[model samples]
Target: MSKGQQWDVVSGVGITALAVAAARAVETGRPDALIEDPYARGFVGAARAPVKLPTTPAEAEAADGRGYWAQVSTYIAVRTRAFDDYFRQAAEAGVTQAVLLASGLDTRAFRLPWPERTVVYEIDQPLVLDFKLTVLREHGATAGGVHRPVGADLREDWPAALEAAGFDRARPTAWLAEGLLPYLPSEAEESLFHEIHRLSAPGSRLAVEAIGNIPGALADTAANGSVRTLGVDLADLIHTGQRPAPADRLTNLGWNVRTVPATETAAEHGRPLSPAFVERDARYVFADRPPRAIASSAMSSVIRPPV
Candidate 1:
């Protein structure tokens, strides 16, 4: 795999999932998990990802630095569960529309017990989507029903492509920006939200996994600054670029926000968070519309699931 393809970003999640797999391994002593996802381990092993250490220990360590891969495992588990909860809540609230932005190798549609008429739209790079679909078919995994896979770069004009693929943005939408925004430049991050806000309707809900606090925050020393000072680096294993805005940027954009620390999110999921997972506040936002609007591409376009 090349360094910076959309597929490459998929690796971070893979590592996190594989960490979860390790947890699963510790729990069940099974190579095959109910997530039954052999892919997580296979991908890491095939590419030798875990073995590829960063050049400088500090740079590698300074990065997402999953040196504490075990700790990261807890985070991935929490995030995946949180998003799933958001999806279930949205469904219970009678909102049938859900769009996962930058939806890498996500298999939620296949795993979750979605309500009837629920549609899960996954958008990601063509190559990444292709790899996942091929693997999924080989694993005998089908989305069951009402799943739309739109292959496109989120940085480009994906809204048009999404509409063409049958997304109904005017209705209530449960939107997710998971494992994405931090990869974008600060401006690009803003643009991404503006685009989302543009598309959302009155009852729409939005959730984000944003970097806020970290354990090192309370340290009297300044290694990477404070716990809040360091956020997720865009690159995994390798240090690439930086997206410097704090997690609070979302609030500035006129959306209601909720901040949840790793500890709180862990407790919500009924898990004991490791110390590494603690020491900082991450955000899980819920933003609704003002019951008024300027036109957005999603608002004007009428779409239904391409079941």
Candidate 2:
């Protein structure tokens, strides 16, 4: 991994910036909040330089200081909170091992309290992991349980990288695909999860998030933001084996699947979104891996701490 520098490359800087902004919004106490992530504040402090806002005046203006970026930040914040709640609830339900794929700027392993022997693995590009490590060390933040940082790309030989870093696939895992899929190519995602299913043991759990309908009718506000639709096919991003059906999707691929709504989870967790946000239909989901049907463990995925 590159030495301590930028943790987020790709559009991840945008995503990380959104995550940071969302953390700020949630801390500010928005009424439509889905979950609370107090730890997000630290990532702002971790930055050694000022963040570069978007180039165009409209984009820049909307990106920050309470405009378009503010709206994007709020959506990202609510999503973060809901996903955190999902993982936390999954942990409480007894899932042990966790691997956070593309663990960009996420602080879950440190902020989330876990079972005594819980082990967390974080996978991301080398430089990304290195940057996070530097910030976390400076801030004196540590992983809640046994934490391992596996610096590698999901599109590469991350499986070997993880195994070298002490990942044990036999344990039940709670997988998190938060704020990552949209950046990847459709073909890469298939290879990615094919490995995930291959390495996953029985009783593993999976939680996923992805880009939603960006058509104006779906979310007019979302269209005004710096975000892009990720321009990938839904079937590849959602399910490769099952067609379009949610209930039968994961089951066809060896896991029990349930699609949870961002709006619903928000309300259930006491953070109600405005009707406008719901009408936008930003996509998010929660799924659990059932016991392996055909046994052939291939590889799983990473986790990260606050920067």
Candidate 3:
């Protein structure tokens, strides 16, 4: 990863955000949609995309004539639903503070029925957040709760920036890291979780969409030709290599962790994913920090006093 690379809403990794938004727009138009993101189409429409992006299911099918967007759209829809349910569960459990790491064009702050007095912090690049806010404001959209946009690179000192934005480390928070892990180098991914653990209070919750391995299509020239046609090389955007597993890391850090295969989640939602996507061993990881007493006891057991 570059030390200080930057991108806007239509270039580099920023384009990937637009792609996801397009998928969300398609999903929202589905009659059997699991999640409704009304503003997703607006983001896709406002962007000057390098390639024509589909904002409806028919358009998605036509664009997938090469059989790329179909699987990707389904996978993105399933993933979005899973994370939406995660946040809803977190809210129902009375964890009000929420943080979306690398939050790109996500409309959750405006869409989700967050409890009263909830505060949602979105952390991402300055330009990315600025673009999102600009478009949402044009549509006359307002967040359901307190929305704090922390414009800081994830590889840098985002924790301090988040705190400066009125993030309370003492209160339990619901954190989401969707479509973000693969973009970070292995070491940086580790550092991200460590910082999150440090900043989290007891009873904090986390949801991560972890990519277990490089997708086969990206590694195959012929198979990935369809992707390149879209004018963005995902392989170039992501860091590929072995990394610390998020579930294992959080478990060792004293949080109760559960791992669910993406395929299983898709199956549960009655939306089967293509093997091209699931063959990668992608999964969702949910973890919860125990209460203060239980966490302290668990830490003490893991770390004994010096003799």
Candidate 4:
């Protein structure tokens, strides 16, 4: 990916962000869908990118054909539902301040019925944020709570930008880093977690989609097949280098952590495991920072549970 300062709908890693929206739009149309994003289809239509969203069963069949796209759709569906539930659970626990890092065409800020006094800060590229808000406004969709769009790159001084956008770092915050890790280099990924830990107050929570190692042949098929079919090569955009374990890092940072495999998440949601399961290395992680008293207590044991 180019290190350009600007990107629109179809260019660079920004296209992959739209690609995820396309997947979500397809999933929302399914009768037994795991999650629903009412704004996803609109974003797809508005984008200049040739992002294909399967609106009919035949179109879906032709697009997937029991191959890479099929698995990609299934994985995204499961991932979307899991993260949706994570935010809802976090919000219910009275954590009002929320931030969606690398938020690309995500409609949770407008869709989720949040509690009073809730504020959601969405951080993403300037063009990405502008395009999303423009499309959303054209569709006449209203936000569910306070939605703050902080236009800044993750590699830049984003924390300062987020604070300037009215983010209160002093309060307990719920942070979502969905579909962000793989694109970052190993060192940058480390820096991202460290920054998150630095800004997090006691009782803060985090949700992540951790990337794992995939088998060689399966990876090759996905790189060739899924990439061309979707008009976005996620494999090419992502870094395959070894990354520090997210759960381990969070645990060492004095956070209570839980990790779950995508396969288990699929089974729990009654979705079929992707046929390319052998090649896909994906896991969901949830971490919570304990309150001051709990962190100081000797009985503070990290809670590890399968989602």
Kindly give the number of clashing pairs for every candidate.
3, 12, 0, 0
The alpha-carbon lDDT assigned to residue 281 of candidate 4 equals 60
In candidate 4, which residue ranges exceed 4 Å CA deviation?
A: 2-4, 50-56, 64-67, 214-224, 294-307
Stretches off by above 4 angstroms in model 3 are 215-217, 220-222, 226-229, 294-307
lDDT of 3 by residue, 1-307 (tens): 3768788878888887888998899888889997899899999889898888899998988875765676777889999999999999999999989999999999999999998799999998898999999999999999988999999989888999999999999999999999999888777899999999999999999999987866564564237563554568787878778777899999999999999999999999999988778777789999999987847778899999999
Which candidate should be chosen as best, given TM-score against the real structure?
Answer: 3
Report the alpha-carbon TM-score of model 4 versus the true structure: 0.90
Q: Regarding lDDT, does 3 or 4 come out ahead?
A: 3
1-307: candidate 2 lDDT, tens digit per residue: 1223234533333335334433443344545444444444455445433343332224434455545544444556667777777778878988778898877767778778877688889888776676667767777887887888888777667789988988788887788777666545555666667777877877887777744543432235334433332221222222122123323445667676777777766666565665556765656666667654543343321333346
| Candidates arranged by lDDT, highest first | 3, 4, 2, 1
How far out, in Å, is residue 68 in model 2? 3.0
Q: Global lDDT for candidate 2?
A: 0.60
lDDT of each: 0.58, 0.60, 0.87, 0.80
RMSD of each: 9.7, 10.4, 3.9, 5.9
The per-residue C-alpha lDDT of model 4 at residue 72 equals 60
Candidate 4 per-residue lDDT, tens place, 65-160, comes to 665555666788898889889999988999999999999888889888888679999998999999999999988888777889999878767899
